[model samples]
Target: MLKIYKTKLDEEKKLLEDELGTLGQVDKKGDWEATPDDKMVTQEVQDEGDMADRSEDYEERSIKLNFLELRLADINRALEKMNGGNYGICEVCKKKIEMDRLEVNPAARTCKEHMDKVV
Candidate 1:
């Protein structure tokens, strides 16, 4: 069961990293930020209207990159726990997390009883 969960989470982490890499590169702190792909566009757009459009596109990419980064963090955390022998333990209650819940979300940090709790 743990092997299966780890495989799935590892696959997901790789996929998320690949998706995030398309939008941005990793910083020194390991955080991903959207890299503006429009250096030429910035140079060409002298008008305020064109500048605004470029900014909007950059903002959308930034948001998507941030979301992917968060997911990657969760997946990495789960992997770390797996290595530390605490993979299936709930963060809030410190109990063994339900296998069914782990099956659905291997990155879960809380048990089913504390599902409403936020970290």
Candidate 2:
């Protein structure tokens, strides 16, 4: 059972990393940051529409990158817990997390009772 969850987590981690790589790069602090489009240096006057489009695209990528970063953080935490022999335990209640919940979210940090309190 643990092996199954670990495999799922590994697959999810790889997928998230790949998707994140398409939109950004990891920084010196190991945090993902969205890369903006290269600024055009041509002498021709730039259109306002083009500038707005670039800005919108950059904002979208930033939002997506942030979401992926949060998920990656959770997955990493779960992996660390597995290594420490503390995986699948509710952080708030100190009990074994229900298998069903774990199946739904392998990185869950709390049980259903404390699900709302999860970080």
Candidate 3:
């Protein structure tokens, strides 16, 4: 039953890691730090418009990195639960999570009833 979920989780983890690698660098603590997409910000003589574009690109990359990191965390947690024999169990209600919800998100930590209430 968990084989499919495990496979999906592994695939997603790889893809997210790859995407995150392009957008940022992983710190020594294993946390991803967002970096500017435009590597041409080296010289100190940048114009206002150029600086603005670089700043905007960095903000975009930061936002994307954050989202991807969150998803990766969820996938890791789900995989851990699977290893612990607790996968598909809602963290909130402790009920069996719906298959439909699992289908939609293999990393889901809650059932459809408590999806929005999850922290």
Candidate 4:
């Protein structure tokens, strides 16, 4: 069962990395930053509308990247727990997480009882 969850988590990590790569690049500190679309425009005359569009696009990418980064962090933490032989245990209550909850989100850090803890 743990092997299955690990596989799923690995696949999810790969997908998140791919999606993040499309919108941004990892920095020296290993944090992902959304690439500005304006950087792609070289010597291209841009009107105010064009500049606004570029800004909007960059903002959208930043939002998306942030979400993906959070999910990736969860997945990474789950993987670390697996490596430490502590997978499927709630971080707050130190109890075995419900199997159904694990099935729904293998990256869960807390049981249903402490679901509001927000890791």
Question: How do all models score by TM-score?
Answer: 0.90, 0.93, 0.93, 0.94
The lDDT, on a scale of 0 to 1, for candidate 2 is 0.91
Runs in model 4 deviating more than 4 A are 38-40
* Candidate 2: tens digits of C-alpha lDDT, residues 1-119: 78998998999999999999998999999999998776723432287787777879889999999999999999999999999999999999999999999999999999999999976
Which digits, one per residue and each the tens of the lDDT, describe model 3 over residues 2-118?
Answer: 899999999999999999999999999999989765455577426778777778888999999999999999999999999999999999999999998898899999999999998
Against the true structure, what is every candidate's RMSD?
A: 1.5, 1.7, 1.4, 1.3
Task: Count residue pairs with overlapping backbones in model 4.
Answer: 0
User: On a 0 to 100 scale, what is the lDDT of residue 47 in model 2?
Assistant: 79
Residue 108 in candidate 3, Cα distance off native in Å: 0.5
lDDT order, best first, reads: 4, 2, 3, 1
Candidate 3 C-alpha error for residue 118, in Å? 0.4
Highest lDDT: which candidate?
4
Instruction: List, residue by residue over 14-79, the lDDT tens digit for candidate 4.
Output: 999999999999999999999977454765434777777788888999999999999999999999
Clashes of each: 0, 0, 0, 0
In model 3, where is the ten-residue run with the lowest total lDDT? 36-45
Q: Stretches of candidate 2 above 4 Å error? A: 39-45
Candidate 1: segments with Cα more than 4 A from true spot: 40-42
Q: Who is ahead in TM-score, 1 or 2? A: 2
- Identify the leading candidate in terms of TM-score: 4
